[model samples]
Target: MSQIAKTKLTQTQLDAHWMAYTGNRQFKQDPRLIASAEGHYYTDIDGRRIFDGLSGLWTCGLGHSVPSINEAVAKQIKTLDYSPAFQFGHEKSFLLAEKITEFMPAPLNRIFFTGSGSESVDTALKIARAYWRKKGKGTKTKFIGRAKGYHGAGVSGFSVGGIPANRTLYGQGLESYHLPHTQVPGTEFSKGMPEKGKERAEELLNLINMHDASNIAAVIVEPMSGSGGVIVPPVGYLQRLRQICDEHDILLIFDEVITGFGRMGAKTGAEAFGVTPDIITLAKQVTNGAIPMGAVAFKQEIYDTFMETGGADYMLEVPHGYTYSAHPIACAAGLASLEAITQQNLIDRVKEMSPIWEACVHQLKAASPLVTDIRNYGFASGMSIAHIDGEPAKRPFQIAMRMWEKGYYVRYGADTIQLAPPFTTEKSEMDSLINALGDTLKEQH
Candidate 1:
């Protein structure tokens, strides 16, 4: 394909590719066409490389076009490109699953694979429901998700997800409730965890008491909400949720699609924060987004319940799976990506480099024209915008559009500009992000 003409892609040629979760009309008119990418930059059609600030949506931690990952996929294609995951097993897939367990919290080691974060989320929801039914508690079918949470756009995710715009059109969401999201006003512009937000976590207990815990099977939340704006949990919030879930006999599911794979500066957010959950739904960084894949890590007891509850050898264990459950090519990419993360020591890099990242993010604090608030932890930060009264999102969208034209890619929405650069991003690259953001903000109003 590289041998083909590297001609200019006119608006007509680009129009056909349906965009996702974007203002399609606005984007198509002013498209920032990327022709190639390497390391922390994406080369545009004119050969101008734009800095990648979101790590291709919180994946690509080892950086773009990592040779090791590309070579592994290339080799796998010729060796064993495809395979059936049902009743048939492949070495790479099983090996990848086993490898995943090594990073999971102890006793929460069983794995179920899927093709994306939404599938992982849906998978978790189904497993939570199934696990309860297997234990003869069939009535515990409902779930709880926190407000502003994003689990992706799939059916089950859309069902349990709490984002209003993502759910309003769907009409019937799951039979669920939400613990109020913890973005306290007083904590605006707070550094890592908000000081005043732990009390808000008590909302879960109130909901549990009001709804009667028996009817609820699980409570799922992002350890640090990403797309809804990188709101890190308050110091004791997750621990409180865990305590409440334990007392109520409810399962806790951490939607770690953004928090998993070293995003929060640890192998997993549960480890980063010292609070464990029954399951963690993961994707994105799993294969560095090179190949789409997702997974659900669950405790051993949940797997045992399914096995012990099932009839005999002839009976199916759990009636859940995907056609591309353990795809050979994806499994290949996952193995390579996992190796790259460990070998490059990116998780430790996140831990060591976070302070510098924080100082850089705070520089925008003085440039209040571009920032109303800032929230960060590990390698991630989100900057809220000072919006006009009737148009809360206008400033953010305008600034992001400006930044896009200025050779940078950053996420802005929900009234803030979000950043989760690759774990390997350099101090210089970090400075560039802040500089570009500062320039964009100066131009916003």
Candidate 2:
């Protein structure tokens, strides 16, 4: 049992710890705490089983307390518990890197490890700038992102992330511009990749024309936007972006934090969509959420440029990394998670499950008047509700709170309720999830 399970916290004690991205005052007044999790359910402090509808913030897609991951973490802790990441090497890090690269597309084989998705995004941005510098294009420092696209929360991620609320307070940390988001008016309630919004990719060209292609280092976007609602790209959108980037000599970066692993029914969104980026930022299910770990995968040319540009053999090619970069425990967990995913053909399983998920989620559009749109791809989905009065995000927040009371835990942001069930969840469980959501919507009306 964990320490949280053993000890109960008072309202005052909870107040001491400031939470992130939460309404702290309201939470303290009525806290909803989870003591433990197993399979597709979380056991609350009072021993109530709550269905995990959001995959624990779009992380644990393999479910909780996975035996393979638990065993790997336990065994790794018993052996080499910690290692200094800099100036020293560990077998597990190199082995895990190799394992990860095997699943990546050709030429995108080099991996730089980080502690979280934020770090991975920042690292990719740094690599893009550094690679341009090495190629004698030191002025290529600007980055282009799409509106409503979300990278992680690092400084660079924040700059490139196009969510207005996430950026207005922090100020742009990098010289970044945004392309129009692909969620057009006609594409609402799209089942998979919508047919509309393909022209939205041309917005990248407009930015390139406005900013000048030579000034841009890279363009970063989530293949399927996760946090800024589960905004899946249009059918030909990603391919067009790839073509534009190539024509302009601009590097492309895909923030695959949520879509990587089996979430998209493929090893990576690049593979699923048949469009490859120069760099791919990964985290989340990389370790099945068993440990904090992220990685930046680069093409061979990018890796070689850094290696060849350094002044001395002993000098660091890229002067960036976390102390926990490639932590042994994380590597072990990642290896175990990857093994389980591949050996069990979890990606194929997700493909089989996606159609059913699409059908179940789309049905909400007709059942709930509040549902403005429903978007789905692979095993992930988002149901966007009409704003309550003039206040956006209030209705979804209320719905989420009601869901918690009814023994379901989901995620909501900006009038959107997102759901990404674990790959291991059964068809009946999915039916129950949709039914509960439908019932909740009905109650609201």
On lDDT, the candidate that comes out on top is 2
Candidate 1's displacement at residue 221, Å, is 0.3
lDDT against the true structure, per candidate, is: 0.88, 0.90
lDDT of 2 at 422: 94
Model 1 poorest ten-residue lDDT run: 1-10
What digit string (tens of lDDT, one per residue) describes model 1 on residues 164-260? 8799987886788888999887897788888788998888888888888889999999999998889899989999999999999999999999999
Range of the 10 consecutive residues with the lowest summed lDDT in candidate 2: 1-10
Tens digits of lDDT, candidate 2, 1-445: 5434344776568889899889988877677788899999999887889999988878898899999999999999999999999999899999999988987888899999999999999999998998999999998999998899888777888899988888899864888999999889989887899999999999888898899988999999999999988999899999999999999999999999999988999999999999999999999999989899999999999999988888799999889899999999999999998999999999999999899888888889877898999999999999888887888888899999999988998899887999999998888988888888999999887
- Cα TM-score of candidate 2: 0.97
Error of 1 at 40 (Å): 0.7
- Which stretches of model 2 miss by more than 4 angstroms? 1-7
Rate residue 138 of model 2 by lDDT.
Answer: 90
- lDDT score for candidate 2 against the true structure: 0.90
